[model samples]
Target: MEFTITNVILLFAVLLVIAVITTKFSSRLGLPSLVFFIAVGMALNHYIYFDNAYLAQLFGILALIVILFEGGLTTKWCHVRKVLLPSASLATIGVIATTLIIGFFATYILELEWLEGMMFGAIVGSTDAAAIFAVLGNKNIRTKLKATLEAESGSNDPMAIFLTVSFITLIQSHEMNFLSLVLSFFWEMGIGLVLGLLWGKVAVWMINKINLDSSGLYPVLSLALAVLTYSTVSFVHASGLLAVYVMAIFVGNSDLTYRTSIIRFNEGFGWMMHILMFILLGLLVFPNQLVSIAWQGMALALLLMFVARPIGVFLSMMFMKYSFQEKVFISWAGLRGAVPIVLATFPLIAGLEHSQMIFNVVFFVVFTSALFQGATISVLAQKLGFTGETKAPAPYSLELVSIGRTNSEIVEMTIEEGSAVVGKELRELELPEDTLITAIIRGNKIVTPRGTTSLQAGDILYVLVTKAQRETAKQIILEG
Candidate 1:
């Protein structure tokens, strides 16, 4: 027992340290750090490495709860609200269409029974939030694009899980019944949504009701509640992942105390969970199986790239006003990660034929998706003009960050359409004695502001406040 505990501690230390060093090194090379994490897991898998997939899956469930909760907390509701209807529609209709399309194609192409092929399709249909969040979440993408992807990733899993499990039940009985399957899907999804919203509402109330001894402890307490809440919901046959994600979104966006600090803690914890999950997932992959799966997986990925995804997104965006470029980029960014592997388990546990085949195909799909889609989304974003403004690293919590501040500062000076600050000479309203208004950027033009220059309602001023009194001068300038 001592030896086993010691080994666990040692392995964990090694993995954690390696994860930190590797992710930083990989990020410098413009590669997603997740690839490195997976490689390390594959390296560990060499020569037995415990020889059990279930153990890693057990860890996956625990890790996923944390991941889901963190995801919920980090999501911005302001961004999602603008596109909720379209995003929700895409999440539901898109998953169903993608599954059906793939299922029918697989039926003919793989010569499998309709039910079996449908199961295969269902397992891979939903995008993995963990994977998507890890790679795409931090980009300075536009609000609409980011929210659409975020909502889709967060909400689509229940649909996929339902479809996967429903087919598993049918295959076990060697039959398909329309009404029963429909009812089951309806109950699971409805329950998952209702549970997530309710859990989020309760968790918000709890966070507000309790005043912890330390502000720092709030994040820990909230996270624990999130995990427990998730597990409890799932035990009652609800979707814990969905529940926690929704809960986090509410708590994250709400006017709770110490929210800024809590968000930072959750963000850091979320990254660690992502690193651990990818590594565990990678360890479960047998490199030999990947070699055999290479062609089929690559082919399926192409279908995703050229056929299924385009159809899915096209149908999804039917009434939505997304530009063609925006739609195209969305179609291209559907990377896969852990959820498919988890769903693949239904086949194995249900004693379905060729469970190993399902696992192998999923492993391959996730690999291709991460490698191909993950690497290319940025390039396409630029090409499609969806990257809006120039990109910068998202700043951390403690220190405020700004770009191009060497000689200039972008401070928010509120000129309420017709305020005195708006129609005043820079010399008269002139702000601080030292500060200079460099440029007033409105929409996209650089209006050079002089002593007589005035601000506009929708204008954003580029005031060059000195390094000293950058704060005090802005306050005085605005007060003037």
Candidate 2:
């Protein structure tokens, strides 16, 4: 196969088509699409050779920025607020605990030195936001549980990243300065948080004030800002991934022009990054190399899954209100994904003596975690009685597009049985000033709402209201 520009593009298109088709079937089979993506990449390696650790690491970092930002952008502040403290605890303390436990096990079981074991542990310690978001896609789990998992996964990468970098530095220098380590940790986290919030506000202001000529350009603007935020934060020696995620949350929650379009664009782009990163990573792995470490990899993975993860979760949430089953489920959901594999490449790039061995082990661990844990998450939720009823998506849709800043936006809500406004006409509900019911969806029909349109159970309402009046309007219609 000649690797000309046209031939390369043709190959890329074919891979994407295969990936999309594989995702559709993976959903039906209750498996994560990442598995198939990696399979595709590994299959391609037979014809096209690729093994550049530095390039893979660079691409992985970029993909993570988009993936993390998208996760934060779509997260609802209302849902995350209640679980914020617990999630933070899990992301920081829980990650540390998991690392230490796994590190100890690796030293004895895997017969590695203490530092090497800790480095290996740090590489795989945190739950992957990409895996969590992909696997838990509208699974109807308890709201708080889902929020905790999502928030923790989205935020925990900083701690793991910090630990991995610190260990690698220490290994290279053969020096252990505890005070410097502590200070560095604080510096990275503090700067990342401060800059994330500040940059997010600035980004939101830019989006609303610039008023781009074309609606399509709004998403492009957002994409540019996201990359800018990550790079800017990273240049200051801070956690760029953390900064990007925080900035995205701010932008996503704010009222701005084309907010919906921006989010949708990032969501689609994030999926593309996921597929590309996984496939590229798959191409880097050698099946024969993985087989050599199979026993050690399986042992460490089991230890992390059965022992380290459960202890970490329980300790982190001991003072919280989660039930025992919820805690167990949270432990089970500590899925490893692209992050660990990407982190593994760090060692290789650093030229560590056992870097290849570490990469292979980490890859195997992530593969096992994603396959076993990702596949059975829903079934476990059912058994634990944590599943909740999810409203079916409306067949009809409504979107609000603005070329300039607007305080008012569209909100969608479903009417449940015995709602206060049920059996009442739209005009009779006494909605807040300037509130307008745009459309009422009943069964298969989209009804343009009017004074004479009576609300009924199972109706989906799309209303336009100012940000300040949103809660008041919800109270009138939903709790009436």
Candidate 3:
């Protein structure tokens, strides 16, 4: 129980191990890991004694940067391209609509000042990328719907962050300038976008040109560049989180050396940040305070899920071409996670009259969202007929490690029944130029393919092909 460095480290390590172990139970119960992580933090709050709003906010922002960057890195441009416009609209206009709706409702429900109500709204406005990513990780949703949700979650934070800061200023200073606010929003977003794209290109070039002695250092280099990107953008009064996400998108999609390794490392690192952020947030809560605000928090959470989120989503995509079912699913999937809790710290730091109340409500809202919305995402997807066929990962894997940019890479394709390639020899199939079937996985055996080797149904093929011919090779193996 002593507050020493060794004790702190030991406590942290033990907590992490327990959190990791809880994932198995969480997954089995179809709940997001956040629930358990937060539970663990709350259970230890008595012994740990962590109530620093400033420190929690700082760590939350850092954790969010890594989490958002990882989300961007894993986002495929091809999938997001078609849904970009709708997603952007949701991220911006939808967020504003949601905030206003919730703010007005909160003003009447909680009898708070107008600005304070809006501040509460802004704090919980954006759908959390961390929560969305975690819940949808295994869900087989349609491509357009999935991409829209993912892209919106990844990009929506900037708008929410801007609004929260602006409202806090208005609340504190008791002044409002419409023109100035509009200009500031554009400046923050525009500068963040430009810087993200620019830094992404520069980072990719550096990674390829530097050619580090150790492959492990590639991840470190990326990690440093990400932090630098955020810090530099923030220094200029722009949205650092947006910049980080955009930069990661470029780095992830580029043909850089050790790209896979870098991505995998960030994925793991991002998970660690998620665990720490949620637990730290959980530690900040006092059970007695939560009980006092429990009724209001539950009412607000219900309003967000049933009323505000749906209205926001439908209105944002009014001109877009999405089915009613798709829209409904999207609305249901707006789960809140670390961002709202992080933003809640802002009010606390400002020492607002109702700041503690706001934090408790936000914390409760996030918990309810993770527990209810997170748990039912898959069932809703299926009920709405938006679920796609889920594929199990390949038992055997291959990575093409390189020290520099390479055109050729390994692609995996599963040979389903009724394929043209079935019962055909490798030499018999007219494969794409420069494409080679490196290995065939049949059941538990790894077959070293030869010219005479015959392909069969239920075979997983690893083909080495250049990016230019990648599609053609895929068509041949998968379709014919």
Candidate 4:
């Protein structure tokens, strides 16, 4: 039955309510709510559907845009800079290596044809930044390792998308002309890079130039630009994900008048996207079909976990000074999520043979990744001895004053493992004159202030300080 406009709105309303309830249940069960969201989607498909695959895909794209944009916005330039070289190299090189290495294993061990085996490899190469940020955003891990994971997840998807689409094309045409393939891949990525940077610069200029007084309207404007950037870049055969991410990052880190509102809007949108993507993809999966390939998927997943991911991490970062534990976390951090499954849809839509099998294998890989990696990241972080502070960002505040001319300040502090402030009252700490710990986002909770506030490590503080006494204020906070 076709859903009318009223029905569509009602359906979404019902889904949202269910999402909140399901997430609550999943949290109590020690699981990622994403799994329950997938189950909800499958259940809905049994009794109801959107009546259009295109609609499902449309929602998927919207979700990815929000997810990537939020990631870009939250990504700190300094955090990524420290592990920049390793992270960038891992995203690029590790993606390629995992694909080919797993490809060969599929061909030899699974006794599949070369093309199909490569298809499986290509499907699983990239890590999902959405999943990483969703799970790890709340953890208290070291800054360096977290940066490495976040940056890798943020950048690797485009490369994996490139590889998957490229392999699909090769399978259809039976042509693997090496030079053409290499050139085309580089060209596409190059276009995405150039276009993304260009679009971001232009968008920011327009945003800052147009003095929009309505804080609410500014988020709408930026979001419109984000969608436009994706469409325009993809229409020209560039990476839409790349373009949206860059545009969002530029808009996010810039001095916009309504930066807080914009960030809030995008963050909410990102969550909705995640829920929608997982649910729709889950509906596409047939649990019965997955059983037949159970062993095959398990074997391939084991190879990826035990062999491909770790070797890629160690080899790529051999020159780096990462400890053994950091290396293990790096390997474990290569968790796949909805991106590979989303890419799996490509082969099916194109009517490739064994596409369903490909989809199921992709499903298995993603499932194991989320199940294993998501559950153990915090414990692994502690075990690895890189227990560096990962202070979450403080609550966002909006003000109209010019920060440069005014006496307002931004003070930075690191929370130690055993500081007195760990469980003390903020009032007792005697925070200095006119300084507000405006935001105290522990994990993802933006803590509202009171006299009984207890500080925790990995909590980012956006302190509004006195410009003249900013240095002195930093000393007081850090010392305490």
The numbered model that scores best in TM-score is: 2
Clashes of 3: 0
Q: How do all the candidates rank in terms of lDDT, highest first?
A: 3, 2, 4, 1
TM-score per model over all chains:
0.79, 0.89, 0.87, 0.79
Best by lDDT: 3
In model 4, how large is the Cα lDDT of residue 36? 72
lDDT of 2 by residue, 403-451 (tens): 2445666777789998888899887888888888888889999998889
Q: Model 2, 104: alpha-carbon shift in Å?
A: 1.5
Better model by TM-score, 2 or 4? 2
Per residue, candidate 1 scores C-alpha lDDT tens digits across 257-304 of 445556678778877877888787777777887887677777776776
Q: What are the clashing pairs of model 1?
A: 72-248, 72-249, 73-248
TM-score of 1: 0.79
What is the lDDT, from 0 to 100, of the residue 325 in candidate 1?
Answer: 81
Residue 323 Cα positional deviation in candidate 3, in Å, after optimal superposition: 0.8
Q: RMSD to native for every prediction?
A: 8.0, 3.9, 4.6, 7.2
Predicted structure 1: lDDT: 0.72
